[model samples]
Target: MAKEFTDEDDALLAELGVEVETKKEAARTPREERIIAGFEEIQRFVTEHGRPPQHGEDRDIFERLYSVRLDRLRAQPDCLALLQPFDHQGILADAILVPGPDEDISDEELLSQLGVDDIAQNDITELRHVRSTADKRAAEEIANRERCEDFDSFKPLFNAVQKDIDSGVRITRPIRKEAGFLKTDIRSGEFFILGGQVAYVAEVSDFFKAPNGESDARLRVIYSNGTESNLLLRSLQRALYKDETSRRVSEPSAGPLFTGENEDNDLASGTIYVLRSKSDNPIVTAHRDLIHKIGVTGGDVAKRIANAKLDPTFLLADVEVIATYKLFNICRTKLEKIIHRVFDPARLDIQIEDRFGNPVIPREWFLVPLFVINEAVEKIKDSTIIGYMYDPATSRLMRTKDWA
Candidate 1:
């Protein structure tokens, strides 16, 4: 039986501001739903970690993947607008927009952008099947490698890298394939700047085709801080590709430092002379090892020091040439500057009377051990003498915190 509606019932429904027609909730499109879900996952990550995820091999794999995904989402304006309501952490507010069209991206590149090599099948039935030999092989290849026991032998190499970094011979540039530091370019004795550290490709195994038909090799990577890793070449490539902060070290400057023949007529092949002052002063006699003047001379070292006793630069005292390392095709002035900068921390802070009876402070004298100076020069020869500071107490070269 149908019940009759009265004017009083209609008036009560109108008073409640209810519409007479039944309304259906709108459905979200698949793309919108995916964007929402992805953003929600990132928000959850930020909530749990108390910070946004960072990209690096050291970080959790899932965290690294999420970080890349978040970066992609931030680039899409539509995704940002959709996720604005859910972004309680304000992660989207400071997002950097990577300008590009979606059509320009390939499937492989898209996967790489997401910090992954491949996606698992969506079908549960396919996943339950017996694993193939190829799958097993791929799993074995991705496993962590054995530790490098001979890392001590590479310590000097690392020290040299730090020295190069400090000297501006090697500089950090944005990680890009055009920079010539790709997985295919990986070879033994190559150096790169990755993860804010100097990474050396000490050794590389022969390449073998993976299950996916991609070439892979095992790498012996040594870092500037005396740490070493035996990571897969592909893994290193992926890390470098995904990390925006990952930098490629510029090729060592091939200047007069390496050449035997002089390129410029003005530049001369010289020697870095380390002289011990033969001063009669009690202060100089008290510290023989601690007092030495480091300088570069283009002419004969003996002739240059023949009248050193009358010169204020030599502290008005005769000096004996303690050490001399032949420099091949270098500017004497520039080499002098480099040596002084390397030993700046241990510079001898002494005042002397010049020929004019005025107190003069010499700049080239440093209170450093002779062996350390030799080591520094060797590092310079190999082009790795930049970011190191001589620690007299440790009697070793240490990497500086900030090389820039």
Candidate 2:
């Protein structure tokens, strides 16, 4: 008669010297057992597929098979070993957890207290690992998007901006303060700001057609303020170049300098500065122009634009929207498509007239990130893994169950 083993018995047999029977049983009831069972299932699945899964492909498989009771299974050492790679190291400084001296517990005790048998610890650890990896990957991706071939050639501002993106905040173009002066100098680029920190983007050149009865030439702002005082291309270039003395800026110092605005030109009342980058590293310094008016219009629009330019809120929002729609599709693909159609008109209506005689909303075409806070939080609560796999373009997450 074939030997019969209980779940604990099988684990014990596997732990001890028992081989043939335990190995055979491991193949038969892999997915049914707790802890190592998920890993066995994964190994079997990989074997069935003819090879080991490559990097992120394993994560997809782990997310799918474990999603059933992931919160319960991930804490097991055996399960975590199979799911997480040995060589993987966290990039973010905060993710690297080192026990403090104030704590009475030792490292081993701290690890013990985390309840390796419980799923929460593994889930938290795994999430941190994934987040750190995503931060590194996001930096690489953003660089790729910007077509940066040399890391050294990339600007320091780019690194600063990415740091903000990882934290789920908006990036803002950096601004300089003058002693006892209310003057402001704005930096050029698309950015987001969250909670005082700014996610700054490198300035890219784009041309805008002349507005009605405006100049015939295509006006461009190397950087846009998202409101009035959007500088023209020539104007921005002039700001970067040396004026008056006709001598170039010495020792590679870049900063903003205010050029008084002409009220007669219908230009907004503010000072403009020639901001320059001094080092081999690209760092933009904003010289805030002194504004004659304060709180004239509702602060909402200005606040939103400023924040959006500096924080990861935009990226987070995109992630949430994508994940939400994706979950909707997984649950009811057909119905969701219909719903999207119903909502299409409302989205189309949210447009602003542009200088090119076309509709342009900063969120839609200005290449800025749009993050809706509540929606992101909801999506994260719904599916943690899918929430991370958000699509920037559509702001949606793909569902594993839906694919299955």
Candidate 3:
């Protein structure tokens, strides 16, 4: 407590030619002051950087720490409300990204990544023993997945999807943020590529209100690896959004693939495959760019080529998968006819022996440059491929009417 200065004390100070200074108000508690100081540091960083600090391995240590600190500040309600008056940067509501995988990061590095520079008893903002966001999410995904005992029943569906992908009956499209979807977009009996495994949305529960007042639902998703997850619909969506290579396996469509719409029943999927031969033949080695196997499949490309070593159709040797254009609503056999006819003029003249030494004729392998094949695929998607034919001399697609 401060002693009150009386009028006599003020008069005595005036007699000695000393002036009294007015004391400013110090209303905030020490804890609040510390919190505000820490937050001011973040605001300074934001002012300098024009954005909040981000969490990542390649980022500067201070920036990562600030990011973690900001996350903690926002997560704690008292801190957020108390500092709301001083939130000049408006960072409390920003959709900040969490840290990426830190398995390769050391304990010391992890601590820094999680933004706990001090473990002292007095540091209220220090985060100790808390998992990084990515680790927590990964653990959630793993925890949600369990042994799918009824996997036997779903095995045929996965096999059929692989077969469809191989045969060009169904195609996989990468899930991009711009192309991200909502809970309603996830349909029962549909498939997706999550973490490199095929996931089938076996069941979807009725929608219910989440604690945050948003709508959510439970999902029974089965994976190709014979595992299943009982995760919330939003959780699945978040996982898909985070995985850069995540894909949605489309319903097989025998119609035009890029019309930008499909009926729920249009279950036709297809792939436009571009393959290069591993044959030791002189012609193939000499004009590698001009030689490829363009075919359609509804299943796994690697599995399709697994028996290539003994098959004359693959030039009796193992082959490499160069490119594949996954598309929707195209009939596999119909697509097979379309591409084969497009490049029929450049069909390679090759023969080889099967494992049994039987003289064989190869099919699908063509004497066409790979670019021409890509162009052909684009044309097919737009439904204009029928009017174009491969021109061997010009190495370009020419209209049948324009052919001289």
Candidate 4:
């Protein structure tokens, strides 16, 4: 037989500081349902805006409204008996103790602000108690952060950069290898249909010339079949952007979600930009120098890009590799890590299961493993600053390191 505890038992247990009280089981009534509806509305308001009800008069009025529904519950023997096992005073004591929603955006006080009547729907006390305590904490954290102007000061720049990256054309790398046989001709250059030109292809080269007075950076594009096409620095840039956008859109959204970096570090995520220019065999690639100036420590790939002397198609592929791997690291390490240190530690355990039903940690954790790597990167200050020179005559991308 199930043991039944009296209201006095509930009071005694609560007085002893028990964490929870027992209540008799009974069928949920309409009054209970109404309470749930009202509570849900309150919850939604709080979640979206972040406002808590006032403690004194507002709370008292809310309880009064709640008791009207409880009156109905009291009429039912089962419901009343269920209540008998609850320490009502203790249960109701802190019922309205949830934190205020975002002080700025929370419209939680909207109803009161408009002088609306305190309407009673039902008693939602039980349902409200069922919500996880963690949810409240998380909500409070989100609200507080959202209210901090400094937290998202980069909204404009961030939005613009996101749009630029999102709007670019996607380019995918053609698989070159299959079971002992090369899938695509590595020697003859494939057509990059966008520029509508047949350029000679060449191996990825590293001997790019730096721009000088009256001279421009030259990006040599070589076709697979020993054919070649020369592109000015700007044209190469445009091609890189086109390829990045295309590849980004085509790739499925993997779970390593990207977020904006911190304010302290002016460096944000790296974006691939494509600038179009008409100069052929343009000398000096300034893109490398520009990133170098921006504190980019890993430019071996960029140097290799300069060396490849690739045609448009090959250059496009190389850009994808450089942007995805090298530049990606710049943002994740230099920017995101610094910002993540400010993340609330209490919310660190937050996670969601992937499609495979495996618990996956969020992108924030990726910084943890790269701490040493980032420290090493920051040490190479010379290679990471913006030290590029541009020449209008030849439309060149110039760098001192590549110059004599």
Per-residue CA lDDT of model 3 for 1-404, tens digit only, reads 98888999999999999999988996988777867887898899889757787775434455666676676676667776888888866787655434443222222443654555665464534445544556555546533455799999999999999999888677776676663255556667888998788999999888899998988888999989888888888888888887788877767653255434556766647566788877788878997777898887788777888998777778877788889877565567877887888888888887777778788878888888777787776656544465467889898787665576
Q: Could you give candidate 4's per-residue lDDT for residues 257-362 as a string of tens digits?
A: 2223444544444532221212121221333222111112333535534532233312221332312223332443544333332222211233444445666543
Off by over 4 Å in 3: 1-255, 258-268
- Model-by-model lDDT, in order? 0.69, 0.29, 0.73, 0.32
lDDT-best of 1 and 2: 1
Off-target runs (Cα >4 Å) in candidate 4 are: 1-121, 128-131, 141-143, 146-153, 168-404
lDDT order of candidates, best first? 3, 1, 4, 2
lDDT of 2 by residue, 1-404 (tens): 97677788877877888864424533524333333444455356445544332332213423333332332333334434444542132111112232233212222233243322333554434432233554443322212111134334335545644554455342122221211101011123433331122223344334344555432221222111121222343332232231222111111111111112233434332211111112121111121121001111112333433433223222111111111111211223332232233223223212333334564433221111223222323332222222123333454433322222
- What TM-score do all the candidates reach, one by one? 0.41, 0.18, 0.36, 0.17
Number of colliding residue pairs in model 1: 11
Ten-residue stretch with the least lDDT total in model 4 = 246-255
Query: In model 1, how large is the Cα lDDT of residue 353?
Result: 91
Best by TM-score: 1
